[model samples]
Target: MAPHDLIEVKNLTVSYEEAKLPVLDGLNLSLSKGETTLLLGPSGSGKSTLMYSLNGLYPEELDGKLTGERFYRERPYEAFNPGELSRRIGVVFQDPESQFCMLTVEDEVAFGLENLDTPPDVIAAKVDWALELVGLSDVKEATITALSGGMKQKLALACILAMDPELIILDEPTSLLDPHSRQAFVETVISLQQEKGFGLLIIEHNLDEWLAYVDRCLLMNRNGKLFYDGSLAQGFREHYETIQREGIWVPRLFRTAYQLMERGIIDDRKEFPMELEAISPHITHGFFTKKVSYSSGIPHLSLENVTYKHIIHPLTSTIHKGEWVAIVGANGAGKTTLSLLLAGLKAPSGGTVTLNGNRLKEYRSESLWQEVGYVFQNPEHQFVVDTVFEEVAFGLRLQDLPETEVKERTETMLEHYGLAAHKDRHPYTLSQGQKRRLSIATMMVENQGLLVLDEPTFGQDEHSAQEIITLLQQRQQEGATLVMVTHDMELVDQHADRVLVMENGTLAFDGSPEELWKKGKRWLAHHQLQQPFRVRLEQAQKKGAAAIESARA
Candidate 1:
């Protein structure tokens, strides 16, 4: 192991009590202090498992068979005392709430310091410093449950920061945050790393927000083996095709640049641009394509002065048939609540929600569900059956379809979702990406007219997320209206016919995706929103190119 290495693993392997196959197999990896490394891999490719192993959770906190050697600070893992490893190597999980144990922000940050038997005076000062470092000093006494998703994430970081760990590992930390919050979170983490000089290992499916900050990249294959470890830019350039084929995400800018080069529209650059400003000078006339025009069909659902307690203010809107709508906003902005109201899952407190020509309240529960389907934010919440096959078939069976037809349709759905191989496995036993697929499969099996999905791509890999979107698009082509609550701005830019912006329990903006992007940056920032990477690139091309040309002249 290198002298600067904070943690090193040799011949590492871990296996859970499962049917077959170890989660991690013969993996060798290392992390050094004062460096930021972004971990990339297909969903369920053992990225999280590797994180758990590195932090000393394998074979102990987690019930597993571990066969390997790990070293910390050039010493063997066995040399550390109980709690010693965790104090030095802290992990922030995907769900921030899962790691929080205290009631308030101040107490939560202080909890870690107190556990180390820090003096009372030292605890208060450390808490303040950590909170300030994360920009949470004003909310120090706020209850954990009341904080927004972004705040909760910051608090989780603060807890780890207060402990002054040598290494900090974050697993999909920005998956639950909105676009603006995601940008802020990435900036904060990168800035903190620069100031504190802590080793950072982050795992994320989407690489847009992080590609600019992380200098090194580590990729793992589906078989839990290292694929590449090198400079971030060079790795993507050298193995672009291989990485793309492996179902890993390529930042949109890089993909666009590569596509343009392949089509002879632009020459290949030695380095991929990480910022919109860098992409400006390369813009060509062929780069600008005509915008797509979306048409609205007949209205399918309507909300007239809809208000649900304090969560949704009196809102009025119409959803047309054959339309794909995206609801986006900050954490407590009532996007999900609005979706629930539209799906007839929740009754509005003060207004009326209509389906077709009648009020939603007039229909029976069975009839209402037949027309409107809702997929929960957490995929596991909607799972009912034991096996993967049964979960997909459950909705079909509820329709009382013939056994033969049900079997055929269920098998087809399973095959389409790439779950045919694991049809016998319990739905709960599947990976996060697999569970999301099963949940959507169950909902789409019966062909409901109006489908509402919350964060459908939350835990998915690049390929799986694209597959899910394609499926939803197919259903839309079949005349199904879709309303999705998502934080993925790129998805909205590429797919949505209309966008809904929510803020403080009210509908702040409703328009086409392009129109939303046209709302100046100041306005978007006020609502805690930002343009997709593609739009940002386009803007830079239009506004920044003149300066480049002038300088060249």
Candidate 2:
């Protein structure tokens, strides 16, 4: 290991019994102290497994086999005492609930310290310092269950900080947060890392926010091998095609600039812009113009004065056939509750929901299930069978379709969603991303006219997310109306014909994407939302061009 190396792995591999192959294979890597590195790869590419290995969770906490050497600060993992390794290398998992043990925020942060037999007075001071660092000091007395997704992640970080680790591994920490909240959380983490002087390694699929700030890029492939390990600028620019082909998300600015160059609309001779601020001077008039075009058809679903306890207040809206509507808000903002009411899964406390001018209450359970298909936010909630193939085929079999037809359709759905390789595996055994895809495929296989999906692309990687959205788009083009609840503003901007802004159990804004963008950043920020990347790029480009023209005059 090098003098500054915080963690090092030499030919490490992790294997689970349930999996057909090793999750990670002979990977050699190193992380330097105080360096901020971004880990990028497709879903199920062993990103999480690698993190587990780094923190001594793999083969120790899990029923897995590890064969290779891993070192922390020049000491082999086996050389150090059990709990001592974790204190030196802390981890913040994707699901914060998994790592938490105590019920209240204060108790949770101090749990690790108390276990270490630290003095009560020291624990108290550490708890206060950690919570304040993550900006959760005000909510120290609150229950863990009461916090939002962003708050939960912050609490998780606080727990890690109290341990005073030399390095922190964050596994998609902000994927569940809203656009504005996600940015805030990233900024807080970066600031804390700088102040504490700890090594930071974050795994994320969405690169829009982190590309501008991250120092190093560590990319893995489907084979669980590290392919590129270097600076972000060189890795992205030099290997753009491989990155895109693997379904890894290219920063939005790079994608747009590359496409324009390909079309001969922009000169390819100039250096491509990586950050939003640098893109404006290279921008041409109308280069990033957003052209909105959507057709409104007959009303497919309507909610009139809909009331769902205090979760959703009296609301009225009409969703037209073939139109895609996106429901977006901060966590606990009633986006899921409103979607439930729309799908006829949850009966409202008062008011009415109608389908084709017919009251929702009038439809039989079987009849309603056929017309309105709902995908739960938790993918595991909807699984009814063991194997992936059986799960997808379960609904088709209920329809009494011909065996041969069901077999063909089921096979096709599995292949399209990238689950064909895991067809025989149990649904629960699949990766989070793969499970989400299977849940969606089961509903889409039935070809329901109206689909209600909550965070449809929740755990999907760049490639898988695009495949799922493409399939949904195809269904919408074939006359199916889509109502999706998502925090991905880019998806909403590029796909949804209409946008529904939910805030504090009420409709804050109901309009087209263009109108929503026109509401200005301040109004959007007030609701805990931010403008999409494309819109930000367009604004920056205009400002940059204006400044250049003024300077020339």
lDDT of 1 by residue, 111-190 (tens): 88998999999999999998987778988888998786667877898899889888999988888788787888889888
lDDT of 2 by residue, 303-327 (tens): 9999998788999999998889999
lDDT, model 1, position 504: 88
Q: Which stretches of candidate 1 lie over 4 Å from their true place?
A: 102-107, 120-151, 265-269, 281-296, 548-553
- Residues forming the 10-long window of minimal summed lDDT in candidate 1: 287-296
Let me know the TM-score candidate 1 reaches against the reference structure: 0.93
C-alpha lDDT score of every prediction, in listed order:
0.85, 0.87
For candidate 2, the lDDT comes to 0.87
Per-candidate TM-scores read: 0.93, 0.93
